[model samples]
Target: MTTKINRHLTWQRMCACMATCAMAIVVACPIAGFASVQTASADDTANTVSTIIVRDGMLSRYTQLGGAQGILRQPLENEHPTANGGAEQRFQGGTLFWNPSLRGSYLVRDGMLSRYTQLGGPAGRLGLPCADELAVPGGASQVFQGGTLFWNPSLRGAYLVRDGMLSKYAAARYEQGPYGLPVSDEYAWNGGARQDFQYGSMFWNVSDWWKYSSQGPYPNLAGVSNLNVAVSIASQRVYIRDGERVLYTMITSTGINDWTPRGTYRINGRGPSFYNRNEAMGARNWVRFIGNFLFHSVPIDSSGNYIVSEAWKLGQPASHGCIRLTVADSQWFYNAIPDGTLVSIW
Candidate 1:
């Protein structure tokens, strides 16, 4: 009876050892369906050590993006709460903001990351990035919840435009338009807001928005008007047109210091000759368009002798504040251009 009882005890011990070994094997082998291990941290204790499992969602995304070796480098923080209950994790290269309901996580990095943060990150008008940055023709671009951000190699960095400003930009064909890409965020100016672009700026007020092109201030004809005079400061040329038809083109000189005002003005007065004692010079066939501003011939001396050197400055900027035309051109202008004709200078 004693032998039989000893044998029974040995068998029970063997069965218990087998069950323990099986459990250990199950734990050691990784589960096939679960995400691969991303990162592990350990907590030290006197009698036990516990492992923190960092996996799934964001972790999975991080792993796919090359993790420690990718542009994002290493994770700087564990996943944390953000606006709208979303989660975000900071990395050496950039940041990953995750919104599970919105499908998945998206990355914002480099110059774009800085700009996004400046605009208030996910809490700002831009919200979260909807997708990864895309390679555009000239640079890169990324779309967001509220609007889009664009980057160009030729520009200082990335910039964003949204709401009404974005609509205006789109209407002008974005980068292809006269404005090109945005150079600045919408900022307060005068009484409203202003957003600058590559070529021009857009101003906003309580009632409406308008574009101020850097090329020059042009009046909105809507349809062609009867007569308008346009001046090109850069080209140093004057265009006299009738409802879009080129009536005449004349070489001219503008303010050397860019003192000539840029805008649409009316021909308010005309004179046969006038002299500025302060400037010690005079001109003939003068037409006043605005305050102390005029279109006249090259400078003449008190002896009424044409200053040959001043006339040589045609097709360039050399005047104090007036538009200088040639002797014959000014003569024709004084006689032909009537009062109330619009003059646009840039």
Candidate 2:
């Protein structure tokens, strides 16, 4: 009618420009895929938040930034990229970390909390140094020589070293004792007091009055009786034993130190006495044993020569502290030690 209505208005303006170019390619393909999925979901919600409260709330709201007064908004803070990125902060105010399975690396700074390690990567080095100062107290047990702190006086516990020594739960807790005796190959007598013997090489056996019964291993004779007989300040050289056989061979001289007085006294009195040098000492012949001390013999040196000598000082520790023997070794130590014998002295 007007050409067919202007050709139906150009054909409806080409069909409304082809429906506005198909709605501009369907809204630019979803706004460029929703702006690349909203920029990858806001970079994954800023990497899942907490980088130590986002670096302490961005250094407490940027006291300054680009100019660098407070700096670090995110140079790095609690990173941990896969398992190796390593980071966990608090910096100028304590707590810092790295620890990729103890490949180690930490820092707390002025409030103390140091640690470092890395010599080969994958976290492998650090045999020492790296806390950047403040070591002092013998510089960490001298770079781990004292082995990183210890006290263990037999597991009273308090140890912590690593790789160098002690750390199997502190050497398995503790249980130590028996350190005094052990050297027996079987002579079976056990008696103990460090196998007692008064004078060197070992010998003790005496009976009759100045008692101390048995002990003898003389010059390696090894007749082993465990030992415990000691007397020398003149209790008449008694050391005796003729039964179990151990004998240091000698006896007879007692009583004179102001009439016998020096503490330990025994052997009350035995038989056979006669030569009497004012009762004994010099040939009381055979006065088996007696107390207040006496097994006599005196005048050993102005040489009136009354022989039977092992001569332990001739004024002989001055008698009454008696033990002077020689009359046939005091009749074989009163016929070989008997009555309750056990003597000890300083």
Candidate 3:
């Protein structure tokens, strides 16, 4: 478990990529640069106090690998100092970084750089670009010793997915689910990493899609899910719909042995509430669809035990005048449907 305070504190830690230094350069050094250097060949912009100096070997490599023929085009700035005694240079396509202990330079560009800069660049937790940005299906990404940055046009912006949080994002199909793309960097939360997405906030330790709100931690199911409902007395089935689109059809148990009034009904309020002749604690998420009859989990006996086995009774006619649903189905019914929505029973 994580402490409540840990979820709120910010740390100055970076990743393994910046543990060393490389080629020299100039910029308002706030973060460590990522790369290595062999020799120097100054550009025309060199000898200027503001532009810093560029190396000939490094420039040659860049020209051949990432210059005119490459996506980066031309150099934007000369080499400069980065955090942790590192050197760096800016190119149209991206930024180049070098550390003293390494033998070569690494380039950072595209969406990866965008996310890094958002994370405070080298000055923040992700010290430097450890690897070149790589292409993937539908988008691009770069791996830092500290974490991974992901960019997909559909997500609208670059975002970080690192640590155990990566597994959580993958579980939700990484930007495909209702959670959408991450909008905020991972922070301490509930003793684990937390990230906010387009649809919801993900807590690595607490849950994949939950946020602390005034009402307490809740799922942000705002953009998805809907509230249309229907029940068939003859087939003993419940149908939940999103407008005219069916969200799900579930087998249910209707008052097989008793009078289950049929007609249109408005769910008045939470069930498990006493009205007419029925009341029980075991019955949960109750919604009254007809007189005294409710759409609720299997009715519990006087002793407070569910009298019907959910697996066995489903898809069959059962229940004591009430519509019987499984625990999960009942919860979904209550949570997804608004109180005043129409519940048609036929």
Candidate 4:
């Protein structure tokens, strides 16, 4: 017990000595060194005096943005002339990109900055930022990289638009077109490039997007291939597609006992036709595909009574080899589908 007490006293004396030495060093150090150390502290939010200088419009704009206490914090770099004869100033959390074309410098941050880096900043296609993020119809946007990164505070991120797609979006009055602002970057699709937008997607398979050409339902179809129909026996659902874009989807039932042949076919004809072994007028609404595979309604007896057991088996394979759809869906398919809609099963 005496040894432990002595050891504790010795440790306390050592700690006091260490603290005194630290205080002595601080007292001996020059004031400039201490200021330098404080400037580089971990709290980037610290509002230390910055020696960085700004002038003219840059200074005016910096003050307007609330100087040191504002969102921009402190200026990290000096203002420099851009290739477009404009000026730019980088801040702690955002950047002020200004061109003679604008009233004041626009601030950019968040998803806008990340996308700017990805698009290669000023060195890439989008040259200097002509404007800061400003309000538009649905949300806000900033013009950069010769395009715009649109942001909505309520939405998670911004959408991108530039080049031909931007032209289309503008032509459609900005989000007024079938293809809205691009939610995704351009990617390889169907031997060409494609981008997704808010309202719908656009395809740039090196095709004439501005041609106002009509393919399927789009007066401005932008994809490489027309999205078609697909039926999965396993999941028992139907999908109407335009490339990867699913126009419509519905739950369906397929054949049981290997009766549903798995192959791709088209809508060769429509109904007022017989449904399987039920005979002509056997199905009130139906369509035929493959040799015998059909998209038909729930079974109706000769007196038009709903077959209860067959109705209960709607999502399961109950038909001989036919695909079953609800009555309204079957009726719509029979009445609406043109003669040559594509159909595939597996």
Candidate 1, residues 234-304, lDDT tens digits: the string is 76777777866655566678998998999989999999999889998999989999999999988899988
Give the per-residue lDDT of model 2 (tens digit) for 230-323: 3444333444433434346333334444454444434444554434356343333233333444454432332345443433333235454556
lDDT of 4 by residue, 77-134 (tens): 7777766666777877787777676646767777788767676666666766767677
Model 4 regions lying over 4 Å from their true place:
1-50, 81-83, 100-104, 136-139, 152-155, 176-181, 190-192, 205-346
lDDT of each: 0.70, 0.32, 0.59, 0.60
Candidate 2 runs further than 4 Å off: 1-85, 98-160, 164-169, 172-346
Ranking the candidates on TM-score from highest down gives: 1, 3, 4, 2
Cα deviation of 248, candidate 3, in Å? 15
Model 4 TM-score is: 0.45
Candidate 2's displacement at residue 57, Å, is 15
TM-scores of the candidates are: 0.46, 0.17, 0.46, 0.45
Q: What 10-residue stretch in candidate 3 is worst by lDDT?
A: 8-17
Best candidate, lDDT-wise? 1
Candidate 3 regions exceeding 4 Å error are 1-57, 64-66, 99-104, 167-181, 187-193, 197-201, 207-346
Q: Write the per-residue lDDT of candidate 3 for residues 198-257, one digit (tens) a residue.
A: 444556665312113211133333664555567777656566656665445555777666
| CA RMSD of each candidate after superposition | 18.4, 29.0, 15.9, 18.0
Off by over 4 Å in 1: 1-54, 205-346
Better of 1 and 4 by lDDT: 1
Instruction: Give the Å shift of residue 149 in candidate 3.
Output: 1.5
